[model samples]
Target chain A: MPAHSFRLLSLGIGIVKLLRSSDWLIVPGVLLLAFFFVAPTVEIALSSIFDEGLTGKHFERFATKGAYVEVFRRTLVRSVWIGILCVLIGYPIAYFIVHRSLRTQVFLMLLILVPLWTSILIRTYAWMVVLGREGIVNNALIWLGLIDKPLRMMFTTGAVYVAMIQILLPIAVIACYSAMTEIDRTLPRAAKVLGASPWKAFRHVFLPLSLEGALTSFVIVFMLSMGFFITPALVGGRKDAMLANVIAHNVEQLNWGFASALALLLLVATIIVIVVVRLLANRFVGVRSVGMAP
Target chain B: MSRKMGNPGSILLTAYTVAAIVFLFFPILIVIPMSFSGERFLGFPPKTLGLRWYMNYFSDANWIELTLRSLRVGLGSSILASVLGTLTALALARSQIPFKKAITALFAAPVVVPTVIIALGVFIFAVRSRINDSELTLIAAHATIALPFVVMIVGAAARQVDPTYEKAARVLGAGPVKAFYYTTFRALMPAVISAAIFSFFVSFDELIIALFVMSENHTLPIRIWSDLRFELDPTIAAISTLLIVFTTAAMIVADRLRRRSARKPDA
Candidate 1:
């Protein structure tokens, strides 16, 4: 054999030897993800821009269309609000949970975890049951003689916000709780011992320590809220459709190119949000702890 | 700690937390009771209490079939994700793999990437490949989402097992495979099982992917979604209650397994 052929043969043999190594254990997973996850994602990105020969019409439509722009705006606005609300509600609960006895802590944590593990669809449905015309709140109002007729709470933006927040709150709590756990519980007490009031200690010492976790939870919730489908579709009015609902509608209508374009927009927006949040957090919050797991 | 009981601030905090907990569980609390309603329409303080909706769920062939379909998909995807995830975890934890962080992120990307994006991508991919609306395709899609959880859970467990045990097994005449299987794999079984259960639920509870992919065969969530869209009936409440119970039981089992494994001494 010639030198070049011998080199090629050696390379092929080297490949075989590498495959037989323990490192090959990851090959099946990488291949599976590549085929199903990476390939489809690339296909979407490609099809978005390359429908029958590199057309920009799909993206152009999204840019020019007021309705699509409105949906995108609403999705971002709602996601931001939901993220803020989750952190607001979740931070207190996490603080409360972290300060409890070990047994009480376990019990409190289970309360959060149970809801976390439950299906989002079911949780959203539960909101439907509670927020419907003849649902619990309306019924209770009438029974209390506060209203003569049922309130139309379902199929409204408020319903969407409430359901979304409820669904995403457990995640926020878990994130906050984990982060709070990392902070020395006695830090606040140490501040108190140094003559600061309890509120002051929490505001100055504990708050800063756990802020990163709160920010992380906010980002997670915001990203998830951006992709919400079942809740908004079930609870929101016709005007309240999010980007995901619109994408789903388009996909159902067999407008693959448009749907992929919208998906690309969502993907880009999510990445930007994550990256921006990390940069801001690092800059303002003074870099996350090195030991923190992503 | 001593001041907690009497302090006004602590009392206020306790009140707020209790209210928050109630808010967290509000839907679950309402749905369980409404599931027992005998009325055809959804109403709170259900006038006539009975098992009519529960009976409706059991007797409906469509619901039963969809439930079974969901189970099949869940089982298929969980098994696939668990096997692949376990191997990947072992490789990451035990081997000197290059680009470990990037590889881990690749596996974990499914969890962070919006499901809507994944659904669209999978839908387009399936249509292009002419594998749309198939159980196998659905399983693969579901497995992609479940892959992250399995990797995180099992990978964490794998890292905790002392490498010395496996090395000791190899030194004692066991082959590499046997060494791992006997020493490390056995120790990792609980984590694997729990991860599998969690992945099963991930598929079980998934809807967006199924909605995009399946038209002929509806999964349980798809059926529920349609019912929710068109009607507000107690049957959905019944189904929701059942799902809650099932999920709670599974969570308890998974938690127990995790705790038991956590308590085991490293060899």
Candidate 2:
């Protein structure tokens, strides 16, 4: 009995060793992230509170500031708007692609992806041309004898939305398209065959199935929008400032404590929103796999 | 199916889609022609057509210097990222390791987190650690950002190849390392190459983080950013056209590789 127990202990040790050896292959990547990624992130979060010792002064200052709170609220609301706009602009396009012939689908997909791979800075710059005072749109409008003065198109809220939507629409389209493709075509056909009109079949069967993907796109776009700094800074007026622009402004000023505090709060808020929305969505719609592409 | 193809609904959908595609691609490609404008500021119909902006970009010493620096940084960081990311992906393939889900999520977190937040955090770390503005610092910082892309692309590609090839190599008396090198690594080469190209652009195209961390090591994007804001030069349009071609070519290769792998049915 004693000999058998000793043999079992050695066997357990051998199994553990085998598993860990394979797992050990992941160490280099893990360590790289831990040191560079995790450490810096933890540093930022802890620095929010650390401030040369234990202190809640940064959070305290934030709690009292209405301006900071206003910025946060504006960020959230603007992001939600951007997300909804992307869905509206992208849905029909995505639905159209899914119904096309295979060759046309691939060709159209490449068209979307070309801009995706290109730099956002370039895209943003391109918008500056199209929407500038003396640019193409103004040129066309003037040629048509619509107005004498070029529209104050640049550096406006509408400019921000237009550029933001253009940048994000492809993402929403791809997300919705992938999910829409996975939906069994037979389900909608069955509804039509069972005395339902085409519109009714689509409304009841297809809409519910595709709603999950559109919602997923909305959530993703909103999450990305909340952190947008460049587009808002370049194209938006001072009032269109997002939370990320605030962080960049603070960092430039070398206000580490406040910037850290703002970053930590934004990170926590984003994670919480994602978790809560996902949970609520799962409960109402049932779990469905959604793919996000940008 | 035949009847459905000729319906009014389908026609309208096709029309709308074609229109949307035009909207999406128009602004992107217009820059190509705009790059040839002889005007100083952005204008659609030029008084003259020439390669003046392209000449300006080529002639300027600062532009040449900045381009070289960007190319160097992109190559350095991509080599680092692809090697490390591919290794990690190889290990992660067929992984039943404890906490694998948590580990994968951690690897993927960089993409989800906002660039501003990461840049801020990393800037704070650099300042505290007394790391100065240098190529090494930029490479490390950019590698961190690009690592997730490499891991996702290569890792997904690696999983498609069968493990039995490695076993077959072993049965034929090859050593473990040699077996993996010959079989799994060979299978993963296309993905690894694409991942490296993707990583290069990831470093090259980065702006916000480079804005924060870089000092004298001004990347092409940083140079373009300052120029766009301060000068409003059409030289940027020429540079942008060049960049678009490079990036589009890289993306085309990646897409072809992905489609080929998927359609191959076996590796």
How close to the true structure is residue B43 of candidate 2, measured as C-alpha lDDT?
A: 83
At residue A254, give the lDDT of candidate 2: 82
User: Fnat of the models, one by one?
Assistant: 0.79, 0.63
lDDT of each: 0.89, 0.83
Native interface contact recovery, model 1: 0.79
lDDT of 1 by residue, A1-294 (tens): 699999999889778866876788898899889978999999899989997798999999999999999999999888989999999999999988888887788888888888777899999999989998889999999999999999899999999988888889989999999999899877789989999999999887898899999999999999999999999999999999999999999987989999999999998998898899889988776643543325
Q: State the lDDT of candidate 1 residue by residue for B1-267, as single tens digits.
A: 334676888888789888888888888888999999988888888899999989999999999999999999999999999999999988898766668889988998998889999998998889889998899999999989999888888887887788898889889999988998998899889988998899899999999999999979889999898878988878999999999999999987887676666554644
How well is each residue in B120-165 modelled by candidate 2, as lDDT tens digits?
8778788778774677777877888889988988887877888899
Docking class of 2: medium
- Cα displacement (angstroms), candidate 1, residue A75, comes to 0.3
| Chain A TM per candidate, in order of listing | 0.91, 0.89
- Runs in model 1 lying further than 4 Å from the true structure: A1-21, A287-294, B1-3, B259-267
Indicate which candidate wins on TM-score: 1
Clashes of each: 0, 0
